[model samples]
Structures are given as C-alpha cells and as structure tokens.
Target chain A: MNKIFETPLYAYSRSPDQESEVAVRHKIVIVGAGPIGLAAAIDLAQNDIPVVVLDDNDKVSSGSRAICFAKRPLEILDRLGCGDAMVDKGVEWDLGKVFFKEREIYQFNFLAETGSKRPAFINLQQYYFEEYLVARVRELQAEGKAIEIRGGNKVSAIGVHDDHVVLEIDTSEGPYNIETDWLIACDGANSTTRQMMGMDFGGRVFEDHFLVADVIMEADFPTERWFWFDPPFNRGQSALLHKQPDNVWRIDFQLGWDIDREEELKPENIDKHLRAMLGAEVEYELEWSSIYTFQCRRMEQFHKGRVIFAGDAAHQVSPFGARGANSGIQDTDNLIWKLKLVLEGSAPESLLDSYDYERIHGADENIVNSTRSTDFITPNSEMSRVLRDAVLDLAEEHDFARPLVNSGRLSVPCTYDDSPLNTADGLDGPEISRPGSTCPDAPFGDGFLLNELGDKFVLLTIDADAPELVEEDGIAVTRLEISAKDDTSGAIRRRYLGNEPTAVYLIRPDQHVAARRPNYNENLMRAAIRRATGKE
Target chain B: MSDLILTTNIDHADDFYAALLGAHEGLSKADSDALNARLVLILANHIGDNDILSKAIDAAKSSG
Candidate 1:
C-alpha cells in the first residue's frame, strides 16, 4: 500500500461537527494548531493521553514564521518525535555576525564543541514544523494513541470549571460545545481563550515596528544570522537577515513607531530595501510580508484549574532572540509530563502548579532577554543610543563588551536551578549539569544520554550498582549503567557523574534532573522517586 | 588600528556617514552636539585602553 504525502496546512479539510456529538467528555482538548498547540497535542498523545485539538484555520500558517529554532526546543521536538524531520528540512546555523552600519563589529561562532549532538540553531519555516507535528500526531493516532485534530474549529467561548472546562466551538458546519477534563490553550499571542477569561496579560510592548519580508531567491547566502544596528539598506533603523529553507531569506526592517502598514508592505517599498541589501541584480520574489510590533509580556499564572495555557497564550516576547515559538515549544515540554500525571491521577494536581511556576520563571527570563535586546536595538532614549553604539564600537575590538552586545542573546535552554521539583544537589558536580537543569545529552554507546533517559522516570548509574527500584504505573523505575564501554571517552561521566564512579541521577520523564547523589543507596533512590512522581 | 579606517570598511562609507548624520537629522544644534558627546563616550568606553583613548582624544582635537 502506497502512503500519499499530504500538504499539512492546506490539505486539512474542515469537517462538520454534529450537534449530537457535542456533549461528550474528552481527556484533553488543545486549542490552536500552531507549532506549540500541535506539539502539546502530540506530546499528550505520545504519553497515552487521548486528545482533541481545535484550530481556527485548516491550513498551515503561511510565511517563514518562527524560522529560528534553538537546540533545546529541537531536543523537546525530538522527544515528541519530530526533531529529525525539522533538522533535515531546515538549515543549520552556528555563527552570527553583528554589524554596526556596514562594518561587521562582532560575530558569534557556535562552532560545535566536542560531545555536542545538535547544532546551536536551525532555521525552518514554521509551517513545516506544524506539518511534521501533524504527521507525527497522525502516526501516533494510527498506533491507537487517540489524538484527533479538528481544523476550522474556532473556540468561541470557554467556561473554566473546578473539575473540567466547557468550550463552545464554531466550525464550518455549526457551533457546538465540548467538555474537556483538561483544556490546554496553545492559542497564540492574540489568544481568544486569554480574552475570554479576561486575565491580565501584562508586559512591555516595543514602540518600534518591524517589517518582515520573506524574499525568495536562488542566490547563495551562507547560513548565519546577520544582524545590523544600522544597516546600509535600512538607514537609522536596525535590520536583520537570515536564510530559510526554501531559498527564502527573512529580512526585517525596523520602521520605527509610525508607518503606514499597507504602504510599507507594498512590493516596491520592500524591493527598495532588498535591492539595497542584496544588490539590484539579485532578483527575488516576495514570498510573504508582515509588519509587527514586538511585545514582552505574560500572564502571572499559566494554570486556571482545568484550563491551562501554554505557548503564546501564556506569554509573548519580542522575536529578536527567536524565543517566542522556541520558548512556547518548551512550555509544552515542561507542561505535558505534569499534565499527564495529573490526568492519570498518579500525581497531585499541585504538580501542575510547578509547571506554572517553572515556566513563568522561563518566561520571565525570556522577557528580560528579549526586552534588553529590543532596548539595545531600538534605544528608548537618547542616552540609551549612546551606550548601545558604544558597546557595538567597543565590541569590534574588546572582548569584555562582546557579552554586553545584545543582538538577540541567542536562545539557550534556561536551567531551572532552583526548581521545587529538584532534590537539591547534595553532592558536587559541574554546575551546568546540576539538578533542576535539563539532563545533559552525551554520546552513549551508539545513542545519546537523553534518548536513553526520557519516556519514563529512569535512573542513570555510572559504573555503579542498579538500585532495585519497584515497578509501578507512572512511578516505575529503570536503571541505565553507563560504564567505560558504554562511553569510551567517558563523556557521560564527565557531564553527569563528575569524578565519582557511583553517581545516581534520578531523571524525570521530561528529562530534567530530579535529584542526584554521589553514593547511590536504595533509600535515597526510593525517596527521590517518590518526590519526582509526586508521592511525598 | 591607529590610522583612520575610513568609514567605508565594507564598501558603504558614504551611505554609512549619511546614516550616521541621519541619526542627528531632526535634532537641534544642542542635541546634535549631545549625540557626538555620547558617541565619543561610548567609543571611548569600548576602546577601554587609556593609551589608545588618549591618542584618539588628541587626534580628534588636532587639525588635519
């Protein structure tokens, strides 16, 4: 049997929802089919949670939206089973060059270090990401994972209850209501769910407007992030240029506070800037153009009883650092495990509150970074412009000013070093791979450390005896022995075990380090497992 | 490093100069002077070398 490949965005035909099929209760319902929404749905389905996803649009979103995906989000997408496809489809970048006017002032070389599996970042059209996620969800569904996606279903109303949520969705056929045990709002920045609840989503909104033009051309531009404080093309304002998958180059021009949106988006207006940047001879087609004002804000709480918000529904940041979608994807990664545990009644609902707390910290970190980048690029006051340019000028010669040069601090996975979920590191180890941080990926015998760890609460023992962990539903324990043969170079030992031969790492299903001890004992392992699975 | 690395480092000197002045386009005389002072302070901090900054201080003041 031949399986025909379908275009994800446009091929989704709007199916009618019957009024009689309205009142059925669902385990999980996710709103929005963007990268984050589909990711949430796919993750839940992978965890054996039956989910129904709704979206206002039937087709994948247009343009080179959210092209830059950081490595952490890439890892999260990998766990959801879509990382390879995205990396294969996208262009990998490990270097970025920041220019003061036409002169290149500073450059970032992420030239991969030893034991690093993924590149620093990759650029792929957001539509392709959505497409791959949808494909993965369908594959999971075929395996009886129980995930249903309803396109063209706009959630018109949301009623959050103590035990469940009732959503009034309007489809092409008509309007109907569906009750969900848990409703994950993966809706975007302008989330209808956010508005329906009238939650105060507060943050800073940048005054400057940026026009993003995805220009399709066959010309060869090296895969690297090129950012400018004041480029030769867009004078007095900042500009950015990055390569995308389909010979489409995303060029952003800062248009300041006032500009006619329609007038700026015109072909001639965009062509003038493109001609200036890439030279007049480089012929290109304008694939997509959009004008946007960057904003950094988030809800104080992402959870409201049964209705929980993830991604842009909960927070938004200026897109300079490519944190918007990347961070949103991470939100789903942080959320799904806790959500699955709560749904299965294996863990107290308070476990989900940890998602709210940790992700809010993540959002706040993103907001701080994005806001600083926005301020640096588009100086708020006269003195700000002075110091910003000074940093750029100094950055060309001095190493000290390089760190201060905030051309969208390249997205790095934030370590939840002080998370409540982590058993405080009682032993000594590298700070980077400490508890409350992501389980550092290291080359295993033939696979990676993270690949062997996730999908369950697993313990990794370095040349040590395996703790006799009792097998229980949602609380089962498995041990992985990382001996010298498993990693001949001792990369796992260097990153995870430190100098100790018998270090035990209790990793969560989300691949975050829950607790660790240099001396692995039955009592310590049992206690950590209980705390990790939300037992005690 | 000491020589005037003409503003045209990447072949857009004239355009860049125009843009630099353009940053002061709508400013008053006092504001334009303030921008120069700020640029000077910023570049000095970036240079960070007392000896080099001192040289620049003298060079910018000295007549061609």
Candidate 2:
C-alpha cells in the first residue's frame, strides 16, 4: 500500500477543477459504477432521490469476479427489482463436492432444508449482473426520475464542505463541476476515495499468490464444485473447477509463494497445469488468466464527514468462501436504507454514522473469517500444514470431519449486538439466542417459507389467546398460531417457540427476530417500531 | 438464504459498544449511552418492524 494511502488526509480520486458547462447537481453522487454502486444508484433513484452515477469505464468487463451470490445479496437485488433478471440468467447450485487424492470424500447439498423455490446459491457472471443493473438504472431514468449517469468521467478532485460535496469530473467532452448532497466511494480495493479520506486499511498480505483462469472446455464435467488438496500434478498445489453458465469453467490453481509472476499468467503455464489436472485429451481455450494475491484488510472507519465508503474500498478479503464481492454487496444492502432515511429527513445525520458502525464491524468479521479460511486452504507454517493434513486424514474415518476436508468454512450471517435497535427480549442468552443473529430460513405453511417473510417487519404471534395488537401501517404480524394442538410445520414450532412462554416474536426486514415477548408487550413493541424506523 | 436465525458469538450489548460507540477505543459510558439514544432513533427509521422499532426507541430513552 502507498504511504499517501496510509494517511487519513490522502485524497487520490479527487475531482479535477475543469471547465465545462455540463454541470449538474444531485442529492447524491456515487463514484465507480460497479454492482454495489449501481445498486445504490438504482435504489435511491427508484425511491425518487436525485442521484448521479459516475464511472470511468465505458463498457462492461468480461468474465465474473464474483461467481456466487448468496441469499442475502439476492434479497437486496430483489429489492431493487434487478434480482429476477439475474436469477433467470444465473445457474443455481445446492451441492458441492470435495475430493482428497482423486477420491470424492464428502458432498454438501444446501437443499437439505425445506421451503424454498430458489436454491441456496447461484452462479452468475459479474458482468452480466452489472449489465442488467445498468439497464434498470436507465429504465428508472427514463421515467423522469432524477438519475444522471456520467460514463468515462474520471473524478479529479473532491472538495467536501460543510453541507455538500463538489466534484471535478473530467468527461469525454471536457472537465465539469458537479456537486451533490452526499458522496459514496464504491471504488475498488485500491480505492481512490478511501485513500482520499485518509483511513487506514489494516491487515496483512499473504506471501503466496494464486493463478485464476477462466476457459472454455470440450469435455463434460459434473455440475458440482470439485476441489483438490495436495495434488501431485503441481507439487504443493491445490486446484478447483467451478461450472459456469456456458460450457466454460472457472479454474483456480494455488501456485506456491515463489512462482514466477510473468510466467504463471501465460496460457501455456495454465495449459500445463490444466493438462496435468484433467488427464484427458481435451481441447480448451483460455479466456482470461491473472495472478491474484490475497490481502485481508479493512478500513478503520467507513465514513468521514459527508464522504462514506462501501464495497472493496472498505475491506478486501481473499476469495475464500466467495466473500469479497458478496460482502461488498452486503455493505450496499446495509448503507442504502440508512442513507435513504437520512436523505429523506426520517432520521438525524448521526444515523449516517451507523453506516461506519455496522459495516466496519461487518467488514472486520469477514476479514477474520476469510483470513482463517485462507490459512486453512493455504497453510503457511509447518505446524499449520501438518494440522491441515491431519484434519483431512481424519475425514477419511470420521463423518463429522468431512466439512473440514472440503474447506467448508461456512459464511457467517452477521448479527449485531448492542445495536441501538436491540430490545430487551433480543438480549436473551445461550449465545445462539443472541439478539442480532442472522434469522434462519425454515418452512412455515404449505409452500410458504420463513425467509420469504423478510423484506418487511414481521410480528409472529405464538399466543393464540392473546389480545389483538393494533396493526401498524408498515408492520405485518402473522400469527404462527402454534399451540400444543398445532403440528403443521411441526419442527418450526419446536425450534423458535421452544416451550418458552413466547407470544409475539417480532422480526426485522433483514429477517432477524427483533424482540420475542411471552405475551403482547405494547410498550416494548411500540418502542421497537420507533427504534427501527427512527420515528421516535 | 436459510430461514434459521444463526446467532453469532457476540452479544447485543458488546456489539453495540464495539460497533456504534467505539467502546473498544475507550468511549465513556455517558457518551456511549448518548450515541445509543441517537442510534436508536435513527435505526427505528431504518427497520421495517414497527413493534420492534418502537421498542428500540423506548429502550434507548430509558437507558439514558
């Protein structure tokens, strides 16, 4: 990292003070037209907020950076109405296979759970996702909404004042000045905006680097994730084959720490590795090959004054568990609503500060989990190598150890504790009963589901005889209607209510149960609503 | 996403302190409480859950 970037005062993506009359003002200005930035633009614009999306790129890039989109991000995409299109184009996968020395050791089928039309995971190209989102942004703009997209516009200077931010944008025609109420930096890991804000991105870069290549293959392979540990083809190397949309495959090879960088990116080098791994006389054409170094780091703060950070600009984790892009999209999901609230005058500007509060914590947690996974996948020390080997060996005898063999570091759905929104009932014990945990998806009624009830406030009443609570305009309460006599969705009743005197379990939009009351607690319920909406 | 609410290891109180008030950086209880109040009001607006949102506001003010 550059020393200038290390300083909190550094500003690299500064807007240039250029001369042009194409000046426009918006309620918000978003830099970098990536998926997260585009999502924010579409969301705010659809909500009738004036937004300008600036991107230096003229066209969508080829290949997928983030191949797998988890359910949470999918929900956010659904909110923007862009998810359905992506869902149609993407391939859904629920099963993954792990191999040890050419023998399949264990397999995980995510569809083991009931009550979901959609699969647990989807594989889609990042470019296609962006392409679809950009179209949606244009669609919103055509309806006379306030959305201005400035392509090939390089921001030269960013002048932040008391109330608004002024940007010096250099467009294809000339330099122009654009001002906005708020500025969001969705620039990548080497973020110019994050550097400009002078926030320190803290973490270590691993010594080893991996080669990633996407290629078209002639041979047919199982529609499953194939991973190898300690392969003999390339001594001390691990390889993976992931099925893509077409007959193409995304392959990743862990080249030891000391491989020649220039030589490794060559097609012949990739061909040699592929030939050895495949062991078949198959014709393949390499599409893209690059060396990616893993760095696990997060910014100290996600916000500084009116300028805020999101996505890679905030944190960059290794590609382990497919967390990099997934987490960035999550940052968008968390920030967009808060920014919308602040912009709409529903909450104080201090509410904007929580953007940093929650997302920085989220990024920090991702870095920790991702770093641990990276360590397991590519153990650096001798002790780690031996330990990893031992665990894989244990999988041969123990079914419990199978996940370890598969490098299955489950992605944690983040929950917040002590959040300003947490209620007393939310603070229950046993760690697993923590207030801000990720709400689990389970079967509800016939063909109905639990996670499907998200995207809105859900008040689940367990007490059938409890007095009627007035239905608020925005909040929706569903009586689980479960008692000793009820056995429909039998396991769900046993799981959440659990013989406790739980009456009403209030779940938030993010699917987390906010407060569980044994009976109707009007005061607590009202207070919880106020906290969730900033109406108090 | 699965419908099972998977709780993390951290508790709500500690998460609030670390995430919102910068408790890990040595924020005073009074300041944390004040932040807690401000955040409760703000987050109430963000949450779609009315009952919980209202409860959050009460908890914030009463904490102060």
Candidate 3:
C-alpha cells in the first residue's frame, strides 16, 4: 500500500487543490469511503478510469457493524481483488439452527452443494472489510491505476449540472469545488446528497429495536447462525448469535419498540442480558454495544441526472438478512460497469437507467425478504404471534413446515428477471446463469469461466472456433475453445454448454448474460449487444 | 396469494361446524368469548398455514 493509504485514518495535507482556480474536473467522483464507494472506485479504477473518493470520517467503521458478508458480495469483491483476504480473515459458516422456546426445531444449510470459490457467507468486521477494500484500492493505485482516497474530506454540497456534477468538499484547511462527469453518492443511509436533492425515500420501519453487542470471548459455541425465539432467557423476544473474526461473538437481542434507548444501553442492563444468555461464569470483555431500529426503505430511482446513488444511500433494510452492506456492494457491482461504459461514450446515457431499474428491483427484493423475516421474528399482532408459534411447533414434528422457519432469510444475489437488457432464455443451458443473471463460475482449462471473461462485453463460445464476429463499440472478443475431456471434468459443459453442438452467450461489461443462442449467430449477438448498451 | 378458499379444505366441514356451534350453545358471554379464542387458536394450530390463518382473521374481522 502507498503512504497515502498506509494510514487508514487521519486528516490529509491539502494538495494544490483547484479551490479558486478554474473548477478542476474529473471523470468520476465518488462520495463516501465505505464499502460501496470503495467498491465502485475499484471497479472504475480497474477499467482504467480516474476516480476520487471523499470520506467525512477517518479510518473504517468503529465496530463489527455489518459482519455478515454474503457470497454474492464476496464474488463481487473477488473481482475487485480482495475476496481471498476477506475469506481468510472472516469466519465462514453456512449452517443455521432455529430454536423455539427450549427445544430445537431444525437446522438449515445454505449452499450445501460445494466446489464454489466463496462460501455461502462470512462473518467479518466492517472495518476489516473496508480496510481490505482500501488496501485493494492502494494495490491498484500502486499499479499506476488512477484512484485517490481523500479521508476527512466531506461533501459540503452537491450541484447538478446538465452535463456534469459540481461537489463542494469540506476539509480541515478549507473547502474546494470539483466537477465530475458523474457523481456516485454512496454516503450511506443518512445521505446528505439525497437530502440536498430532497428525494422521496419511502418504505416501512421495523419498530422493534435490536441491541447489538460484540463480545470478545473464547466460547465453545459452534460456528453457525443460532437464533432463539421466545426463549426462557429473553422472555417473549428473540435473540441471535454469530461468530466473527478475532474470537469475537456478535450478539443481538430484539427489544420491542417504545423503550428508553439510554436505559437499554446501560452497562448494567447489558451485563444482565449477557449473563443470562452466556451464563454467569462466562468470562468476557465488552467490545461494543449499541441499539438500532431498522427500516426497509429505498429511493424510487437510483440515478438523478449526472448524480447517482449506490449502497445505503439508495436503499436500506433491516439487519436480519445481512443485506445492508452486501446489497450496497452489489449495488456498486451493478452500477460501476454501466457508468464506465456511459463515461467512455461506448454506451448511451440511457444505459444507466437499467442500473436504477435492475438495482431498485434488487433493493425491493431485499426489503421484501427483510420485512418478512422481521414480521416472522416479531409478530405484529396477537394473531400473528399465534400463527408464528403454530408454525414453529409444527416445524418440530413435520418436515413440511420446517421450510417456513424464518431466521433472517439469508442474502443471495437477486436475478434481473425482467431486465430490459436481457434477451429471453430460449437455450437448454442451466438456469443458474441465465440471461440477466450473474455469470456462473466453472473451472475452465485451468482458471475459472469468470476469470476468462473481461470487464467488457464478450462472446463466449463453448467447444467452437472463434466467430468471424463484429465487435460492437468497445466490446472485446475472447474466444475460448476448451478440449472435450477438460470440459466434462470441469463441469463446464454441464453448466453452460448443455446439449448444444455450438453455444454462444453474449455477456455485458458487468458480467451479466445479455443473450445466448443455440448456435453462433452474429446478427443476434449484435442486436443483443445494442440493446444491452442502449444503442438500439 | 390467499383467497377465501371455500372449497372445503377440511375433510368434515359439517361435523366441524356442528361441534363449533354446539360448543358455544350453552355458554355465557364471557365463557363463549373464551371458548371462541381457544377454538381459534386450536384450529389455527391445526391449520398451520399463515396465508389461511390471515384470511380467516380478515374474514372474522369483516362484517358480512
């Protein structure tokens, strides 16, 4: 890492900034140095686009906030060059045990089938996650990539122009204005940019507040998601326990709405709850404790003129599903490539609307899942409680009802089923990576299918010669011709080739399937490419 | 997803109805109310379906 990023926190000395000089312009400026902003910055930087990131705070988040990192976000992070480090640092687990009162109902496994690179989910502190991302950015920057992280610089105001966005940034010395071709607002849930624009952020709030406590203790608890509903220790409420790195345990107790926040967070009160949950003799030191009332809300559109919103700035949801930071990272994964293409003028500006459409749909999916988990855990009415208890009781005996056991329905990547960018799936290929879905990873000759694909449009032809294809816009062609023995051994034919003699799949810059043909067809590929880039 | 599915999901609707009405026949107002609450819970547990339970709640809350 460069000296500029060697220290994660601290106010930076001012460079010869263009405060009064003619407003300095950049290709793109990202607000907030959280996971989403840093992820987007890395995405753009990988595309060789110059990016500047502004953060109000120095260093990463304080505690193990947003501990659960889902596989989808891990995959996205892997592309940006920090996935392995996170996995190494995180505690990986997929099993979850749901308890009703004293007896255990059932245990569920997420992504039980294996051979995938990343696990279903990993528990890591938010600060470490951001630290890895910032480190990745530094690695890219050291490689002569154009990226800058200005810690302690906050966006004072945002002004949208017809073709550019002007942002006034506040620093210790003074404030300066910088214009960008586009501004990505990843300033998180309390986004100043969204408030400045006065956008309508609408959704429901889960009134039940939750006490989050991170305890640094070595306990003989299994590395699995353990959730208790109406347990004797918690009376009529719910509790969750998760394992993070550094032998720290992330504990959550659902306290219903209408309680004094101060009283709830008092050390004595926290000590009582901890003693009840972990027994009296468990030795531990309090790492962190806080209370939060979550919400499942989102903006109507992610993009407004040259300014765009990503991550928590655009949407929010309860912490139940581990969707908050993971979805935000996915938001950048969906936005950066499209923004890059639009910036390079290879794609029309209308291409960015697909980001809003696909991502709003994605956000809505998270909100719906979070809302469901919230309701299931905390019943809204007496009837609701009765109904939930019935299901839980039934789950103990009947296998059919076990599926209804909702313990924060784990996060997964949302497929863009109705994306305008997708051509209908008519081939016999696997549904896992159909059109408008994340590109499935399979062992190619030596590397993975995803590794072969670049950060640009590709024409993937399995077991065939390179097509005499017309490369549209800046789309690059990487012709892959795998041998038959390796094909079956790698599960490549099973996942992608199917029974087709020659299969062709058109992929977009964001690694989403745009279209696929049973056989090579240049005209079909060209049309799909045009539609994908908003050129049609 | 739930409609007031009236296609006789239960095996013996007539028998269940007879018992339901008979259970409330000779009870005072408070006892009848308690019986109704307990009955609702029992049947709800037996049903074991949120969609159906929610529909039943809605139907009971609404006046014909």
Candidate 1: regions farther than 4 A off: A1-22, A471-474, B1-64
Clashing pairs in 1: A9-A59, A9-A60
TM-score of chain B of each: 0.74, 0.41, 0.62
For candidate 2, the TM-score is 0.78
Error of 2 at B15 (Å): 19
Report the lDDT tens digits of candidate 1 across residue range A1-536: 21111344433454433436557788899998889989988888887888888888777777778989988888887888888999999998888898997798878897665675676789998878888887898789789988888877888988888999988888667788888898888889998898999997998887889989988899777888889888878888999989988688899989999889889888898888888888989888887899999889999899988888999899999998889999998898888888887777878898887898789999998887787778778977674676567667767875555766777876787787678787878668767778878887888767777777767788877766776565654577788777755677667767876665567788888788888887677776777777776666
Q: Please give the lDDT score for candidate 3.
A: 0.81
Give the runs in model 3 whose Cα sits over 4 Å from its true position.
A1-10, A18-20, A499-501, B1-64
| Candidate 2: residue A163 lDDT (0-100) | 83
- State the weakest 10-residue window (summed lDDT) of model 1 chain A: A1-10
TM-score of chain A of each: 0.95, 0.86, 0.96
Top lDDT model: 3
Screening candidate 3 with a backbone cut-off below 3 angstroms (N, C-alpha, C), the clashing residue pairs are none
Candidate 3's error at A294, in angstroms?
A: 0.8
Error of 3 at A247 (Å): 0.3
The sequence of per-residue lDDT tens digits that candidate 2 reaches over residues A1-536 is 42211222211233332444565566788998888888878877877888877877655545567787777677667767787888888887777776666566667676535533345667887777777887887788789888766667888888888888888877666677888789999888988777665679988898888888887886678777777787677567677788777676888888888878998777777789888887758688776678888898888788877888888888898887777777788777667766776776655778666667767777777876676667667866554565466556555545544544435344555777666656766423234434555555445545434535545566666543443444543443554454534437555455465656545666655555566666766677777766655454
Question: Which numbered prediction scores highest in DockQ against the true structure?
Answer: 1
